[model samples]
Target: MSKSIHKPGFVLGDALDIPTFKVLKQDGTLYKGAQEPEFDKEMALKLYDDLVFIRVLDERMVGAQRQGRIPFYLASLGEEAASVGSAGALKPQDMIFAQYREQGALRHRGFTVDQFMDQCFSNDRDLGKGRQMPIHYGSKALNYNTISSPLGTQIPQAAGYAYGQKLDGLDACTICYFGEGAASEGDFHAGLNMAAVLKCPTIFLCRNNGYAISTPSAEQFSGDGVASRGIGYGIATLRVDGNDLLAVYAATAAARAYALEHNAPVLIEAMSYRLGAHSTSDDPTGYRSKDEEAQWAKKDPILRYKHWLTQKDWWSDEQEKTLYAEHRANILAAMKAAEKRPVPTIDHLITDVYDEPTPHLRQQLKQLKAHMRKYPEQYPKTSGRLDA
Candidate 1:
């Protein structure tokens, strides 16, 4: 079926212009022909609540980090809709593998304010047992995998998990979340190819938020974007306006349905911007301009969604103020309680590794405790229960 061209010819990669799917415009009205998402009052309100919660959580946590209360933090900031909307479309049974910034999705999936505080403070109540840095969240009960610090580790893991779901004949799929930067990693290629060839039901959601911690997308790749690569991998793909909540929800819902029905992988490239620094440590002023930030500010997804809700009479200005005030109080209370709690004891470090601790491991723990005891002045007494 080849064209059988004898002359030497090369095709431009940009020839295929992918259009971004949009439902809600900047002014909070749907495009003339855009079909509204199937969102009920409860669903719409829940998404809005999660968005506000995430925003406030980011602001407070970043402030906490700056005050030296917490070691570090990452904020979804301008990109809240990407995670919240796609997550809203999935069934609770589906597994989620996120790359740090999808706290909105976790919150939407029932993670409480206290739980978030516990993890950030690395208190005894933290699910990760103080092993991971702040913002790396997970919950077994929620089917959310523990986030690993290394980039792209979860992509292939998601593919493998989706294959397992297929073998078990479970009516569920795995949704993997990562930034465009992670797409440059070999794992992204391996994961997508594995899912495609294995016919695993998986959704690879890429938050194309313009930058990978300061590296702009222009330098990250020369192609059309992440979605264009999905086509190269022979996977179904879609590009969506990440700032449009309804557009994200519709695209993800459709992608989920397609992947499950065909037992194939689908990739979604969400075009958005990272309005905050890569982390509390980095200063965005060094790499980006304020004017650019201001331009994106006009397209704030939460504000857009709020406008739509106001139009529907589902939300009001007073409700916005109340939600922010309530969440601020709740988050502050939770943070105080979590920080007051002691960290997990030293024995906790080795307990979960095996059924019974090995002699060498126990020896290491013993040596660690002795080191702490001998240098009590050097180590924080609240680091763990060294007396044990």
Candidate 2:
């Protein structure tokens, strides 16, 4: 009889698996053997500020969606540590392919409040030219790919891009963020296999948010957790406490080193939960209990991290109050202004693809314009940026 050999310390299906490292507890006490981040007081304060800003942004945008100010929104409520911590460990030149919920990464990378509002409002100044639905963000300078609605497509794209980085022999790696729910898709399998075979320098970050829409993680798979899938693909992998920012930062920092040095993909499974609905369109209450939601809320990323900072004598209640107020005011002011701004220029509809608009494209634009003019009252407001 052949006995199955499992790696030492690699526990499958546990909320904590693989590296499963944690630096701080919920009360902000350090677990023995964990090292604190090498952050000065100024930088630490800025990091806390970013968390506050991201929370406010998510909160306001969700309200916008509910009030019909925007068409849709996806809040990254409880998963901020995974998003922000992973992005924090990377150089800005590294690429990111986010699955729509990692806006905290963008916030940490210095994306302007104006820029966010522009996309949400579909304003003329929006970089995407109002083409994407709200929250679909990208910037060439930032090296972030524009968001896509299809699940798991970015997983393979990330592997392919990382393969290019490997061939180019660049120091930069690619980070692709997706939910554990996304790991269930076929593309997730294909991406991992390609990355393993090609030895691409990629960090596949799976935020196991305990739900695929409203369905619980218990309903998603039979195996322990998403971490098992990474080892199955033969890639180096780590699992971390997603609510513990320090743990996430430390793990991702190590993961980056392993990926960059080897030019081989690494998978990180961050155990966390979504404290909000899947989207503005979803209702989690039907499938999840209030007690469950309350339990996850108690493990809030911002709070836990704040407590850690305080434990180190780096933060205070006064500072937290000040940061929250600033973020709230800034979000409200920017959003109101954005909502009143005009939509993207009509000429943009036929530009950007070629030196000159093609005959077929021009024909389509003309037809669209005619339809708009025909129902001037119906199409009164300039149609918010056309989807390319």
Writing each residue's lDDT as its tens digit, candidate 2 over 88-180 gives: 888887999999998888888889999999998888889998788988998877889888988999999999999998888898999999998
* Per-model lDDT: 0.94, 0.87
**Number of clashing pairs per prediction, in order:** 0, 1
Report each candidate's C-alpha RMSD, comma-separated, in the order given.
Answer: 1.2, 3.7
TM-score of 2: 0.93
Give the residue spans of candidate 1 off by over 4 A. Answer: none
lDDT of 1 by residue, 105-175 (tens): 99999999999999999988999888878999999999899998889999999999999999999899999
Model 1, residue 56: what's the lDDT? 97
